[model samples]
Structure formats: structure tokens, C-alpha cells
Target: MEKIFYYFLIDVPRAMTIWAVLMVLAAAATVGLIMRPRHSGTGTADLAAEPGGPGPDGATPVGAEPALRAEEQRRRALASRALELHRYAEEVTVAAERSAVTAQRRRDEWLTAQEEAESAWQAYEAADVAARRVAAAAVLPEPRTPRTPAEYADRERYLHRAAMAACTRKELSVLQLSDALAHRNGWDPRRHPVEQEIVLRRTVRDSLFAAHRAATERERAAWRDAEVAAEAARSLREEAFAATAKAEEFRRWLPSSPSAGSTDGTAGGANGRVRPAVRWRAARAG
Candidate 1:
């Protein structure tokens, strides 16, 4: 048993020495990995010497930082310009909206004004039509004439008579009659003497004729009324005479005799005219 233990101890020391040697190798590998630079596919010495690599002089080449800074500044300026353009677009959009709103308002106001004007025009047209209708219905006035000494008295007399006649008759308009007389007389008496004289004579003649016709019509109406009254009176007289004749004939033809054995005997007159007793009683009572 002691010999077996001694051999086992000697084997344990040998195993421990091998384990220590492997630990030392692992620590050396770890240190070498930490010191080595990471590389994709290039050699370490080539990567370090390259101008674009991370060496003291290669990290910042001549004019590299200044070029990058200038590029950064340009990018910043472009971004600022883009921001300003966006702001201007917003303002333009706002201004355009306001302008559009104002234009629309103006258009609406104009349309409203046009509508009002149209309404007013329609009203004016209606009024004008009404005025025209009135003018058409009314009698037109006569033109006035200048008076001359030669025809003034005759003209005055004619006018006075016409006015008086027009006043008497409701059918004739005074304005119309006066206007007609004035037109006939002529406005320029000196220039149109013959025409004025002729017109005046014609007007007088017309007035006289009208008056005569009116008088004749009145006389005719009176005659017709008288004829109708006479006819009616003749008819009444004829009816009265016929009634009287009928009454006399009836009195003469009435039977006066009662039949035999009647208590009330009919009386016979001396001339053979028979009278009934009832009729005699009635006459006496009356």
C-alpha cells in the first residue's frame, strides 16, 4: 500500500506540471491577441503605412479636416436654405389663400350689386310701362296758337263757345276740345293765316253741326215719347168702351122670369121687360 501511494503521488506532480504549462501558453496567446490590430484581408504592416489608415500622419492628411469642415458647412447652408424655402412656401400659401378669399368676396359683392341693379331696373321698367299706359289713356292736349288782331276776336268768341259747350256736356273733354281748337287756329298765326282761317271756320262749323244734331236728337226723343203715350192712352180708352158695351148687353140679356109655382114671382114691366124679384130686392137694398 505504501509503494502504491508513492507511485500515485509521482503521477499527480507530472499531471500538474503539464496543466501549468498549458495555462502559461493560453495567457501568452491572450496578450498577443490584445496587442494585434484588427484587419479585414490586408497585412498589418501595409494597413499601418497606408495614407487612409489610422497612423499618426495618415489619420489627418493634408487639407482633409478643412475639406470635411467645408463640406459640413455647405451641408448646413443647404439645410438652412431648404428651411427658408419651406418657410417662404408657407407664407406664399397663406397669402394666396387670403387673396383667393378677397377675390371671392369681391365677386360675391359684385354679383349682389348686379342683382340689386337688375331689380331696380325691373321696377323702373314697370313704372315706365304704367306711365306709358296712362299717357295712352289720357286725352292729348291741344297746341296753343299766337293771337293776331285780325282774328283775335273771332278766335276768342269761338274758344269761349267751345269751352261753354264742353262744360255743359260731360261726354266731351274740355282739354281735348281746347287742344283741337288751338291746333285748328295754328300756333304761327302770321305765317299760316289762310290755314288758320280755314281751320277756325271748320271748327265752328263742326261745333254748330254737333249742337244742331244734339237738338234734333232731343226733339226726336220727345216726339217718340209723346207717340208712345198717345198709343197707350188710346188702348186704355178702347178697353173702357168695350167693357161698358159688354155691361149694357149683359143687363139687357139677363133673364128676369121665375119658373111656375116659385114663391118669388118675377115682375113684368109695362113694356114686356121681365125683372127678377131677387134683382129688385138687391136694387132696393142698394
Candidate 2:
């Protein structure tokens, strides 16, 4: 009975040892199984929970996202500004072209006006020359000699009276009246009246009468009116001359411009400092 009891005790110790070894192996296996991922889902869940990992929320870091967005926005703004600048440049180019066209048109108009003014002046100069030539041709020759002393005396008396009357009118100067009368008779004073003794007396009487009449009878208003008419006629002539001159100047300066038309003063009229009626009569006589 003692041996049997001993054997049982030994078997019991071996069994307890085996049981402890099994328990240790089972605990290690339980820990490994609990820590292991079921599939890749648990790993993906863990990545999602962490920042800057493979999940959607973790793809970009929290601090870096704003910086990336700011960079993108800045690039877009730059592109927009570039487009606006290009459009502005095009507008400026168009405006410049329009300005150039307008300026050219204005220049063309100025050139045309200049040309017109030049042509009118040339016509006036030609007319003026012709009129002067006509006046020179109308002068009359002096009479040769008187038939008798009585005839000479009568002629001298008539000339003296006419000169005095002309002087009284104040239209002719002394020199002009003397020249007219001298030319009508003879230029020589010695042969003027055929009787030299009475010549001085007749001349003195005529001069006194002329002076008296001029001092009393001459009207200021009439003279002024005559002068105004003369001035108007002269102004017309001057204007024509100016137009001609301007045309010449234009030709000299800008040959490509337009031509000017004829002006009014080119034709002759009563332009002298004389009464209109007298001028008209004189013109007719010429």
C-alpha cells in the first residue's frame, strides 16, 4: 500500500506540471489573437484616427491645408489680373489708332484751306496791272498855239475861272488844278495867255475867289462821306490784293492745298478821294 501511494504522488506531480505548461501556451495564443487585425479594415480605421495618415481626413496635415489653399487662390488671382491687363492693352491700342486717324483728317483739311486761299490772290494781281495800264493811256496832248491875243486872253480867263472853281470845291489840290489847267493850254508859262502883262492879274483874282469859296462853302459831312466811299472802295481792292498774296504764300508754303476763288475788288470802281458823281463822269469820259 505504501508503494502504490508513492507512485500516485509522482504521477500527480507530473500531471500538475503538464497542466501549467498548457495554461502558459494558451495565454500567449489568446494575447496574439486579440492583437491581430481581422482584415485590413482595422488597420485603415487606425490610420483614419491618426492625423497625416492614409485616410481621407488624414491625407493632408491640419497646419499644411490652409497654406496649400492660399497658394492655389493666389495663382488664380494672378491669372485673372493677367487677363485684365491684356484687355486694357488692346483698348489702348485701339484708341491710339483712332487718334492717329483723326489727326490725319484734320491735317488734310488744313492743307485744303491753305490751297484755296493761294489761288484767289494770283487773279487779283493780273487785274491790277491791266487797270494801271489803261489809266496811263488816257492822258491828252497839249494844244499848240492860240489863234490871236484875244483868243489867248479868253482861253486864259476860262482856265483861271475853271481852276478857281475846282479849288473852291476843295476836291483838287492847288498843284493838281495847276497841272490840269497847264496841260489843257500849254505847259510853257511864257506862251500861256499870249499877253503876259494880264496873266498875273487873272491868276491872282482866280486864286482869291477859290480861297474865299473853299473857306465858306465846303461841307465837312460831304467830305467825310466821299472819303468813306473812297475808303470802302480801297478796302475792297486791298482785300483782293491780300487774298492774292495769301494764295501766293500758300503756293510757296503748301503746294498741295486747294485753290481760292476770285475776290470782288479785282474789277475797277470809284476808289479815289472824289465825289461818286464826279468819279463816275470822269470814268465815263475816260
Candidate 3:
């Protein structure tokens, strides 16, 4: 019984050791078989087993060339798209610059025109003032009796005819009066007819002089009226042009931005003077 017990302890342990070793060997062999590269017509296992090496069939992996080509095409497409975007961006930037320059030039032209118009307006005003001064210096003539519109309409013709008649009649009357005065001076104290003829000729001459003075005054008044009317018309025309130019300047120079309205007066002129809209008053003046 003692020998049997000793044998069971030693031999059993030794046998168990040998079995464990064999099991380990079998597991290692199974792992090697499972992990080993298998030669195939497709050669997928060779490529999987050996990195950066030839396949078992000695040909490159299937579909690898197509994948590389596809990748190349993708890279080229990306590059092309990037180039197109760059060109588009550059074109947009150039266009924006050109637009800005055009807008600036337009603004300058408009501003110059406005200044010129303003100067013209001032000159017209000065002319009008001078005309008014001249008008005031002359006394406007009035007629002894108010004439009809038709008679006044042909006033120049009437004045010419009337002055001619007055001069001719006065010359005849003076010649007769000179003869009567010479004859009267010879025998005036004895005869009453000589004195009466002298008094009548003197009264006729005074009447002729009064008529001439009235016609001359009327002519001067007509000239003054014409000058005043002409000056007023010129002033109105200049004022209208100035207002219209100012309006056009604002429309052209203002920027196309959200803040453009606020920047109008501030950014418009050298002196920051804002141009007002063309009011109806300008049209009325015209």
C-alpha cells in the first residue's frame, strides 16, 4: 500500500507534466497553421502576411492600381476646384476694385459740376443786383393819360410817328413865328395884331416841347422794364441749374452700402457740406 501510494504521487505528476507539454505544442502548431501565409491564385493572403512585399503569385495586388488612379484623380479634381475658386475670387476682387474706381471718378465729376453751377448762380445774382441798381437810378416815366393795351402794344410805332409830326410842325411854326416877330418888331406899338401873333407862336412852342419830353420819358421807361425782366429770367435759370446739379451729385456720389445714407453729408464734400435734394422751388424759379 505504501509503495502504491508513492508511485501514484511521483508518476502521476510526471505524466501530467508530459501531457501539459504536448498540449502546449499542439496549441502552438494550431496557431502556426492558422497564421501561416497560404499560396493562392488570388494571392490575397501573401499580401496580407508580408507588408510591402510581393504576393505569392508575383503580381501586384488586385484593384491597387485602380485605387491609386482613383486617388490621383481625386487629388487632381481637388486641385482643379481650388484653382477655379482662386480665379473666381481674383476676378471678383478685380471687378470690385474697378467698380470702386468708377464710382469715385463719377463722384468727382459730379462735384465739379456742382461747383461750377454754384459759381454761375452767384454770377447771375450779382448781375441781377447790378441791374436793380441801374433801374433804381432812373425815374420811371408815366403818361399824362393811361393808354389802351392795343395803343401800348404798338408804343414804339406811336412814339416814332408822334415825334416826327411834332418836329415838322414845330419847325413850320418857328419859321412863321420868326417872320411875324421880325415884322412885328418894326411896327408893334401902333398895331395890336403883331403883339397877338407873337404871343400865339410862343404858346405853341412851349406845347411842342412838353410833348417831346413826355415821349422821351416813355422810351426810357420801356428800356428799364425790358432790362429788369431779362435779368430776372437769367437769375431763375441759374438757380434751377444749381439745384439740379446738386441733386445729381448726391445721387451719383453716394455709396451702395447700408451706411451710405449716414455718410452722405460727412463724406460728400471737402467742407462736409451736404447737397440737398432738388426741390420744387427750383422748377418754379425756372
Candidate that would win on lDDT: 1
Candidate 1: where are CA atoms >4 Å away? 1-53, 56-62, 140-286
lDDT on C-alpha atoms for all candidate structures: 0.49, 0.47, 0.46
lDDT of 1 by residue, 142-211 (tens): 3466666756666555555544564455323465466654644333323333343344344444544454
Residues 1-286 of candidate 3 have per-residue lDDT tens digits of: 9999999999999999999999999999999999999656555674656654556667655646676456445444443343344344444444444544554555555555555555544544543454455445445443343556654445434433333443465522454444443434331322222233343334444444444454445545554554555555555455545544554443344332212222222222343323222221212223
Residue 169's lDDT within candidate 3 is 52
- Each candidate's TM vs. the true structure? 0.32, 0.28, 0.31
lDDT of 1 at 85: 41
- Candidate 1 — what's its lDDT? 0.49
In TM-score terms, which candidate is top? Answer: 1
Error of 2 at 28 (Å): 45
CA lDDT of 192 in candidate 1? Answer: 36
Model 3: runs farther than 4 Å from truth?
1-59, 142-286
TM-score ranking, high to low: 1, 3, 2
Q: Residue 199 deviation, candidate 3, in Å?
A: 44
Clashing pairs in 2: 115-257, 115-258, 116-258, 116-259, 116-260, 118-247, 121-244
